[model samples]
Target chain A: MTQQKRKFGFETRMLHAGHIPDPVTGARAVPIYQTTSYVFEDTDKAAQLFELKQYGNIYTRINNPTNAVFEERIASLENGTGAVATASGMAAQFAVFMTLLEPGDEIVSSSHLYGGTKTQFTHTFKKLGVKAHFVDPTDMQAWERAITPKTRALYGETIGNPRGSVLDIEPLAALAHAHNVPLIVDSTFATPYLCRPLDWGADIVVHSATKFIGGHGSSIAGVLIDSGRFDFSSFPTIAAPDPAYHDLKFYETFGHYGFLMKARTVTVRDTGAALSPFNAFLLIQGLETLSVRMERHVQNAQAIAAFLAQHPKVAWVAYAGLPDNPYHALAQKYTPKGPGAVFTFGIKSDNARQAGKTFIESLHLFSHLANVGDARSLVIHPASTTHQQLSDAELEEAGIDAGMIRLSIGLETTEDLLWDLDQALQLT
Target chain B: MGSGPSLAVDVSMNTILSEADRAKYMDPGKIRAALSSTKTIAIVGLSPKPERPSYFVGTYLQYEGYRIIPVNPRATEILGEKAYPDLLSIPHPVDMVNVFRQPEECVEIAQHAVQIGAKTLWLQLRVVNFEAARIAEEAGLTVIMDRCVKIEHGRYSGSLHWVGMNTEIISARRGQRYF
Candidate 1:
């Protein structure tokens, strides 16, 4: 009888991938292997690992057993060939850029981005002579026109931050591939459960595992997952021989795994942004219940979006689930599970800045914070806090309104959350 | 058995070359059964290098409680087990012959496997040879091509997905999550 290859579902992989029952200790759960160095099997084995001729842990900076489990599990969920974990989400982006880009290399990115990302892309990248061209994520023509010969990558968040605009992944991927560039997606808002961008043709996926992947605000970690489908043979960085490692040609040697291996050994190793093993353990625990947590998070978000839309104090809601939302069709196409739990709304008042402050301070249940993807509900007024430095024109370019209050709907009782929002809206 | 063609397993290589019934050969049930039943595996082109794919696969199988015969003429022993130069050199019975050599070398290895009366012939990941497969299958040997024995064992045992392996197989049957 004919049979198909057996792959365990997402939930199963969460619990099992990269984890073997520990034969020596009989450890059932993924053990916290918090060590800076590992004992080599022999001199030959040690040499082999250092030479990149073998896969084994020589140092925590390069690979660890605990981190290996997390990396593999994330790769499995993202449907990628492999993944590498780093210190934070920014580190993941930095590692990718450091691997792919040379001096004067360019990136075309979405303007609708997390505050920190905007700062990194615009400011830090400037110091390195790399340029980032930000465009309206919805404008495919804008993205197309921005790409020049020097452009190394096309980038965007899957469900954009603050304003919940959905990226057109299919067309964006097609556009990037047409120009011999890879589309790098920050899928922090829309986790693998909501939308896997790689399945939609993206080459690399980045995530802040600190948020939904860790569910609780317990860990700060970042990961980059590679689809292994992109051809890097013609690309300068991956295909070229490296002087640092005895002129080893990565793409010629490892084929699909060239970019990721270099990112780990060369970038992560040189930069020293390796994730703490203890933090990786926390992320692993968080990942086990990801699908369950995400379900409730989005469910609460949809109800809260609906609640705020009709409220007298609220002037506008940017949730893609709303019928009048401009990104509704694209949300259906990409993140059909709703455009994530984080979204924004504007308060109707003449003194909008003061009113936004009042709305946040009046909240009893929601914790006013600068973070998202926690079990507890979170609220942030970006204009007064995150985007305070940006000019009116700059804020408009980033899709942020000065009066906008961002709500990352969490796993709270629907009625209780609505009551909190109602009281908060009254104050606004 | 000698390295020459066997009278008992005389067959046409061209008749089974296309492999129209390839699915039957790759059937998950047969693979699981073959893996479970095979006691001894002869790894062709087994390397002495600790980092090589053949070495690690042999080590992993040994850990998984399967006796592995490393077929390398250069190495006297590997992973603390005796290493034979070729499949025919293995005096004891080998239930499966796992090929790690190039596709061009597999046809000869398959012929040797047939002569030795091995039950299954497993080609390592990226080692695809339809002609070798045809020869093995026509001689009543189960053919598993272009797959890593270590990865298949790990997949079955619930411990792979690292080192950039593209894990596409999903099943309704849950694996051993906790041991």
Candidate 2:
């Protein structure tokens, strides 16, 4: 018999691409390699492993079979050369900075980002001697103006959190490429199935696999995908000899796999944001259904957005799916599938905060939560929940409405979801 | 494959080929077997609007007991089932991936269907891609281009006669092949 071609589909890759049936037991499902450490066959092999002469599992913190499968599958989906799995989304972001940055290096970031990420960039990174410049994501000129001699990378989300501000990725990628800086996109919201940033000129992509990628709202994991297209010859981090790894020049040795190699061997090994094998299994399950869930998420969001837009109580809706949205055109070009399921809307009332509270409380189907991109629809009143600490002036400066209602549409029946929103809106 | 080589398919052809003409390119038995065995379908570019033929076909298929997964980014749900933005995003097994998209979009969807392990790729009426069909067939998936699954099911399942439509199938076996 002739050997068959092994060109599998996306779902096939999700189930079988990164793995084969166990030679020992004929097991079909990916077995969770849950051991903490692997034993070496001999002193010579162990020595070679320690010397980085050969690649093999030594420790779970450095690499594991389960995590490797998750990493490879995501890398395939994202159209990346390689990927490094981390403990969480924040860890993935940290690993990127840890691998690329020096003491005096700077990062140009979008002003609109998850509050946690903003704090990490502004406070945590500053303490580590790296400065960050925040710029409006919509203004390409502003991004250019923020870049300085010390700047190493440009960072932004595929879709802005809370506000649903879509990034003009192509222009920003151009800006970063012109300056010889890598554009790192947090594509957690717009998964690779919807938009592959690397195809549009991005150098790096990061994701909080805890959300949609994990679909059922279980497990927390992150991944960093390298396009392997960026030239790191000028960057001292990847190009120069690493004292930690005994003079291993990542760029010179690994070539296209340089970034991922450094991220794994240096950042992940030292910082230790390694994903658990069990969590990797959960993520695998999520990845398998990502296509279907994302479509439902988009459909539910479209229905809810239409409902909110026509409601007399809704002051304004800021969903890219909506025709009047400022980012509609950009979203259509970059993410033609859908503008994503998460969006923000203003609830109108005499005391907008009271109305927001009523609307949130009245909903039985939608869960009031801090997270986004779950299998279940989630709602949060930003002014009262996440942005409660910000003063009214500060909230306005951040472009957050006091009565803003953020919705993360999930995989649910449209009729039930619409009914839930309708009942809640009537109360408001 | 739709035609021997994608290069062989003329770009100027404006209509679907006749059964005899298509027989030169594909096997009808492959499509019949795919429809008979398929249990779940992930419909790419499924519209939420009721008027769309994709919606009605999907609804009718769902009513017939085949699991229908809606694949479109704009809608979260269709006919009570959670929708996916693309074929790759669907977490479960898909027996077939039905395309309700433009011919230009077929290649990407074909790649996604292959990646997702879908057993077959069924392109709706008037939408066809020889390149996509070639890719799917090469990947070992059964490919049925420029045909409606509902029409195929009704024809093969002996349901078309009840609706007064010609099944074009001549056989003594008139019972449903699919349960």
In model 1, which regions exceed 4 Å deviation?
A1-5, A389-398, B1-129, B148-179
What are the RMSD figures for all models against the true structure? 7.2, 19.5
Clash count in backbone of candidate 1: 5
CAPRI accuracy category, model 1: incorrect
Instruction: Kindly give the stretch of ten consecutive residues in candidate 2 chain A with the minimal lDDT sum.
Output: A1-10
| Reference-based TM-score, model 2 | 0.70
| Per-model TM values vs. the true structure | 0.81, 0.70
Interface RMSD of each: 10.9, 24.1
**Candidate 2, B1-179: lDDT as tens digits:** 11111111111111266644355223446555676688999998887865355765776677567899999999999978998888878888999999988999999999999999998998876677889988998999888776677756654443332211222222211122112
lDDT accuracy of residue A367 in candidate 1: 92
True contacts kept of each: 0.12, 0.00
